[model samples]
Target: MREVAIVAFGQSDHVRDSAQTSEVEMLMPVLHDVLRRTGLRTRDIGFTCSGSSDYLAGRAFSFTMALDGVGAWPPISESHVETDGAWALYEAWVKLLTGEADTALVYAYGKSSPGDLREVLTRQLDPYYLAPLWPDSVALAALQAQALIDAGRTDEAELAAIADRDRTAAAAHPHAQRRGPRPAGEYVVAPLRTGDCPPIGDGAAAVILAAGDTARRLAAAQGRRPAWIRGLDHRIEAHSLGVRDLTDSPSTRLAAERAGVFRRPVDTAELHAPFTSQEVVLRDALALDDTVRINPSGGAQAANPVMATGLIRLGEAADRIQRGDSDRALAHATSGPCLQQNLVAVLEGEA
Candidate 1:
């Protein structure tokens, strides 16, 4: 098997609204930034992949338009996923593993401002059972929170603390949308307050992947350490909410084990837990103790860009490893309700 690593990572300044900027426009700058970081150009990329949602962009095949920024005019080896960018990154990693590409570019973006994000996300539910009912994302998350509380796993006050701590930690994160300490505010749902939820935002993020010698060369040229991916895996739970336990995430635990999370202690973890209560569930699933630093970049609670949020978690973890802030790290991304789908990757700097 070929070794792969993240050589570069960059993201746009996440904002509550980016209505003025088109998706292509928002992506162009980020693409330029990441390529410049590694001294590479669009033409140098071996493969390119992206992630986005048509529902959020209010159009079919919206990801095609975003490709304009990459200048695919000459044609490029590319693909896309209609979900979060983290999944797209997963695809690119596999591409590298096959030795089909020496360098791969992966990016994801989302603009949740124009539509009713809550209702739009409901489209992901089962059409026969849940789609028609139209339960908003927050309400669905609230149901999970209440379950955790009833199970004596966590309570409202602890959820509030998670919210406050994460957003506050984002104070120094340049691309973060929500920062500083704020009131937990009123309950949007019975067990969840305003701060307990992630801010609706528009944002983009990009990462560069290289395999084996190519990975080392890219990082060496930039005088930076490479964040090597030791293991990666994803798992999904039953789609029917009634069939699974909301207070626990067996899928997460399974993915973590497959990704080598339990093999050794990771000093840092970037979790894509959009809701405070979900963070509690992930903490237990990943078996993280207080010794581990969780979400130093604020995770999704600080700036949740939906499609791009998961990718950002991986990028933040890799960046920390590259910067010598951590020796090994755990990065997790999720899709669907109540952590139904989970992806985990264990990254480490050369020891």
Candidate 2:
């Protein structure tokens, strides 16, 4: 496989709603910023892939319309996923490894405020059983939280502390939607408070991936180190929530192992645990120690923009490495109810 590195990343200001802005409008700035930072023009990109959902846009082929932001006039090799942008990044990496593309542009965006996001997410559940019940995202996450409590994996106070810490860290992130200190509020769903759940937001993010010498040149021009992808893998579990253990994430553990997360010491991790209790499960699954810094950019708990949130985790971890803040890091992304699917990537700075 070819060595791949994230050379540039850019994101929009995460907000509760973008009633005045279209998805294309939200993406243009981020896309331009990423391309500009890499000193690459749209014509120079070998491949372009995006992540977005027509369900959120309330129309079919919504991503096709978003192509305007990337300027598809000259006709570029493009693809898209209905999943998070982190998965899109994985696809781009695969393309580079195949020697079909040496440089790729990846982006993801979501507008969750247009509809009842909690209700909308329930559609992703098992159609025969869980979908009929129409359990909102918060309620489903609360069920997982309660399971953790019952299994003695975590407590309410610990969950609150996690929420408190994440919100505090979010204060420094200009693009973070939720910031400042937050008192764990009354349960929106039993065992899950307002703070325990992620704030629904609208946002977009873009990343530029370059292989080998191109990556080195980009990093040098930017006067920073490249965050080389050491290992990358994803795994999925049973779709039926009833058959799965909510307090443990076997999928994450498998993905982490495949991604070489435990092969060496990690200095930081950016995890896509939207719910506070889910963070506890992921930490155990990844076997992260107290010495490893977690979610310094606040994580999805502070500002989750659905399809784009997972990609933000990867970008944040890479940014930390590029800035010389950490030598090695782990970036994780999750999908489906109770983390049924997971992607893990291990990144290391220049040796």
Candidate 3:
């Protein structure tokens, strides 16, 4: 298999509203920033992929307009996933492996504040049973939290601690929406609290991937270190809540093992734990220890723009490697209720 490395990454500042800008407008700066970092233009990319949901925007083909952000005048080879952006990254990586495209551009975005996010998420559940109940995302996560508490995997204080640390970390991130000190007290559900939930926000992110000599050239031009993607894989689990175990993410376990997450000690890890309780599930499923630095980017708990959040995790992990801060890292992304579907990517700095 051919090797692929992330040469550059960029994102828009996470915000609550973009009254003056469309999604394409929001993505233009990010796309330009990524291209500037690599000294490459849109025409230089061999392939382009995006992740987004039409349902989130209450419209179809929301990604079509966002293509303007990539300057599609000459038209570029592209694809999109209705799933999270991490899946789009997976598709792009596969395209690289085919020995076709030497470089690829991957991005994702969502303006989740446009609708009642809680009610919108209900559509993700089983239409006949769960959807009819209108089970919102936070409610499903709360169920997982209760199960974790019952299994003694976490307590109120642990959830608070995760929220505190993640918020503190977000303070350093210029694009992070939920930063600053959050009082770790009380519960929004029972174990989860208002402080623990991720902020609903709007944002876009882009990453450039290159292989072999092209990758080396781009890395040199950017004056940035490359984070080589060692292995990447994703898996999905049964969606039925009654039949599935909410306490552990079997999909994550499967994807991590496939991605070789345990091959070596990860200097840092970026897990996409949307809610505080999901953190426990991902931690156990990925087998990350205390030595692993988790969510240094504040993860989804800081600002989750739906389809974009997971891919942002990958970009954040790559950023750590590019900055000479990490030698080995793991980036994770999850979708579906209670972490039903998961993706894991193992990354390391190239010599």
**Can you give the TM-score per candidate against the true fold?**
0.99, 0.99, 0.98
lDDT of 3 at 8: 86
List runs of model 1 lying over 4 Å from the truth.
Answer: none
Clashing pairs in 3: none
Clashes of 3: 0
Tally clashes: model 1: 0
Q: Write the per-residue lDDT of candidate 3 for residues 206-304, one digit (tens) a residue.
A: 899988788878888867678899989999888689888889888898899989988887989998989988898898998888999999998886789
User: lDDT winner among the candidates?
Assistant: 1
Per-residue C-alpha lDDT of model 2 across residues 1-351, encoded as one tens digit per residue: 789999998999999999899999999999999888889999899999999888787788989888998889868899999999999999999999898998999999999988888888887887888889899988888999999999999999999888888889999999999987787888899999988999988999999999999999988889988889999999998878888999999999999999999989899999999899999999999999999999999999768999999999999999999999989999999988888899999998999
**lDDT for 275 (candidate 1):** 92
Task: Provide C-alpha RMSD values for all models, in order.
Answer: 0.7, 0.8, 1.1
lDDT of 2 at 144: 97
Q: Which stretches of candidate 3 lie over 4 Å from their true place?
A: none
Instruction: Using TM-score, rank the candidates from best to worst.
Output: 1, 2, 3
- The residue-by-residue lDDT of candidate 1 on 276-303, one tens digit each, is 9999999999999999999999999779
Query: Model 3 residue 171 lDDT?
Result: 89
